[model samples]
Target: MKKVFCIGELLIDFVAEKQGSDLSKATYFTKKAGGAPANVACAIAKLGGRSVFIGSVGDDPFGTFLLDVLRENRVDVSLAQRTETFTTLAFVSLAENGERDFVFSRGADKELQYNSAIKSEFAGNLIHLGAATALLGGKLEEAYGHYFFDGLTKKSFISFDPNYRADLWKNKQQNFAKKCMTFVEKADLCKFSLEEAQLLSGKEDVAEACRFLHEVGTNIIAVTLGASGTLISTREFQETVPSIKVKAVDTTGAGDAFIGCLLQQIAALTNTDSLAGDRDLLVSMVAKANKAGAITTTNYGAIESLPDQEQLSA
Candidate 1:
């Protein structure tokens, strides 16, 4: 089986359930592990897949808890690093329609540095770039750039999720847009929410956004349309995945679960089949992944609500 390497931030999220997307009058907050890459790693592991997470965290109680959380989900954290800084944290407020608002603090996660751990990780067959803080033009950029670029020529299925954090960019809109676009151009499978797709591509229209992304070399684009399902577009094909009815309680980590389940399915392919080989197969996989995402929303927190193989296969 191919190993899945997820490179990005590892942090804690405090989620609050409320009547609507507004967080002004939230009742209570529940803390849980989060970060797009970490969520994907957990999702893949839940499906009995070999998954690894590569990133840095503060050597604090929160960091330790995050490490334990990853290991508990059967994700490999040997490549994960820890520092003496404070761990990153986010407060999320969920609405009745599954929308969420967040207040993020990247104290230590901003200081996370990439090192010599993943020069050989490209052989893992899949590498997912899903963190907003990753391409912040630091020493970590050079480190991640080396390995990510190296993966370009290797036998790896490169996946990308522009898990854009508006707060991370702040006022550097031009710089952030450039950085994400460059990463998108490198991925074999690209995942984005409608907002991210529009923001990254600067095109509000879905068809145009997909076309623009494809022209930039992203062969497979998965644009998540919230409750409307997903738009799976390839250079040669297009697919719109629909979701099943579910009572969503919290939307935290739903997108990551979708990607995680999608990767788990791809890892089962015995041959050297590319991810964009068949449109029908990709649609089916996305449908299953959609269910995985929807299932997570029925409960609180992220990993705490992720569906296991039994739930998904049922």
Candidate 2:
């Protein structure tokens, strides 16, 4: 299988141990390694896929622990960098129904500087632009663009998930919509949550939103519909693959798990071109990925909750 390269933030999440929606009422919290791209990298590795994580974290205990978690799961983190700044931290409060409220202290995650030399590292592999903060500017945003072109030039398959964080773009929805599509237009596969789909395409209907996204340029578009499952679209096929039913506990990593598993499956195909053309294969793959997502929610924390190959097979 071709290695999947996940580029983006690596941070710590301080989750309220008491499950309730209000962040103010929370009395205590627990720290966990949490970041969308890092979660996806760990998810892929846990599922027996080769993955590489490229990003930066502070040269602090939190950063060290985050890297340790990734390494423990077998994700290649040689490209991960350590910075002098503090590691980014997110305080999360979970409602009884698994919804989350967050407050962020952004730091080292934004310091990822783009390196042209990394272009040679992605040949015929997969590059996933799965960062919520990458589009927010600074060196990380620059790296996001460079990696996109690097993937193009290296004959690598590109996947993108806006991983939209509403907290980060509070009053900048329009700007978020505009910048995200630039990536949507370049990706081979684009993943979106229902809210993200509606926001970006200006279409409330999932099908219409997917159509708008497809027309823009992405070869395959997937709109996640929470418990209803995922709606997948391509020029040749479109269908909703139902999710595996489970009693979800924490929904934090579900989307990341879904996309990570799907990317892993895509990496296994010798001819990457089949991803855009194979309907039955893609459907089967998404169905499996849906299960991965469902299973993830049955536990708490992103990396720790992701299902392993054994769990997935069973």
Candidate 3:
């Protein structure tokens, strides 16, 4: 199977132990290795798929911990960088139902410098742009654009997930959506949360939103609807696959798990011709991905909650 390349931030998430929306009132925080891309890479690795993570962390102990977590999970970290700046930190506040609010302290993640040396690695593989901070600007943004075109030129399957976070954007939300659309236009596969789909397409209906994105050029679009399930759309197929029932504790890594599983399955396929035309196969893959995601919610933390092949089969 071709390895999935995940590019973006690798940081520490300080999650509140108590379930509530208030971060200020929470007296305790549990640190975990977290970042959308890093979580996806770890998810793929845990499921017995090869994955490589490309991002930056600080030269601090927190960065060391994050790298160790990735390595332990079997994700390749050869391309990961260490910066002099402090590692990025996100404070997560969770509601009783697993809803989360985040406050970010931008750090080394934003300092990721562009390196053209890795461009050849994009050839004939899958590269997932899962960054929440990559689009926010700086050298990471430059790297994102450079690698995206390189992947395209090399006939790579380009996947993108904007992984939109409101707190991170603040007043720059419009810029986020606009910049994300550029990626949406070029991506072979794109994943979006319900809110992100609506905001980007300016459509109330999920189908219409997906249609707008399709018109903009993404060959396949998967819009995640928190509890309902995931809506998947391509030129020849569209369907809403229902989610598995589970008692969700933390939803932080659920979406990552779903996409990771889906991408892994896609990467494992020897016959790429069926990917666009096989509706039943696609639905089945999404169903399996749903189960993977559902299973993730039964546990706490991102990487820790991710299921292995045996766990997924069970």
Candidate 4:
């Protein structure tokens, strides 16, 4: 199987135990290793797939803890970097329905510098760009663009997720959408939430949104629809794959798990390029990914909630 190189932020999530959206009122908290791309990396490794995490963290205890968690999950962290800046932190509050509100304190995660030596590793591998802070404009953004183009030049199987966080973008939604299109237009596979699909494509209808994304050049598109399951689309057909029913305790990393599972399935294929034409195979893959996502919601935290091969099979 080809290695999946997941690029993005690795941070600490201080989650409030209270069931309320207001972060201010929340007193007690629990620290968890969290980040969209990092979660995806752990998801792949825990499922017995070859996964590598490529990003930066602070040269501090929180960063050390995050790296330790990834290592314990069997994700390769040799490519991960550490800086003198403080580790990034996110304060989260969850509602009763598993929905969450977030506030971020940006830090060393944005300081991931590009390395020319790593460019050769992209060949015949899988590259996943799913960071919420990737496009926020810094060294990480530059490194992201470099890696993306290098992946394309090396014929890597590239996957992208906008990983849109409303709290981070605030009034910059238009800018965020514009920046995301650059990756969406060239990614081999693209994952999006229902809201992301609509916002990026400027189409409220799911089918139309998929069509728009296809026109822009993504060969395969998956739009996550929560309990309704995921809508998988290729140039030839579009279908909604069903997910197993589970009482969601937290929806934070569900999407990451879904994409991670899908990517791992793709990585194991003998011919990754042929995925777009095989409708039955695509449906089956998405179905498994749906289960991964649903299972994640049954627990708390991102990496800790990811299902392994045993859990996925059961």
CA lDDT of every candidate: 0.83, 0.91, 0.89, 0.94
Error of 3 at 173 (Å): 2.1
> What is the Å distance of residue 165 in model 1 from its true position?
2.0
Model 4 C-alpha lDDT per residue in residues 13-38, reported as the tens digit of each score: 99985468888888888999999999
lDDT winner: 4
- In candidate 4, which residue ranges exceed 4 Å CA deviation? none
User: Please, what is the TM-score per model?
Assistant: 0.93, 0.98, 0.98, 0.99
Model 1, 1-314: lDDT tens digits are: 78888988889998787656666778787788998889999999998999999888899999999999999999999988888879989878888777888778876665656565466667748888885677776655665676578677676888888787776778987787788777788788889989888887889898789999999888889988878899999888887899877888888888999999998888788753566868788999999999999898898888888889999978
lDDT at 189 for candidate 2?
Answer: 92
Worst 10 residues of 1 by lDDT: 110-119
- Residue 17 miss distance in model 4 (angstroms): 2.5
Which of 1 and 4 is ahead in lDDT? 4
lDDT of 3: 0.89
The lDDT, on a scale of 0 to 1, for candidate 4 is 0.94
Error of 2 at 36 (Å): 0.4
Q: Compose the digit string of candidate 3's lDDT tens values, residues 266-306.
A: 98987665586788988888888888888988877989999
Model 2, range 1-314, lDDT digits (tens) per residue? 89999999999999995469789899889999999999999999998899999999999999999999999999999999899999999999987778898888999999998888888989989999885988989989998888998998897899999988888999999899999888888899999999999999999998998888989999999888889999989988789999988887789999999999999888888887777788888889999999999999988788999999888888
Judging by TM-score, tell me the better candidate of 1 and 2. Answer: 2
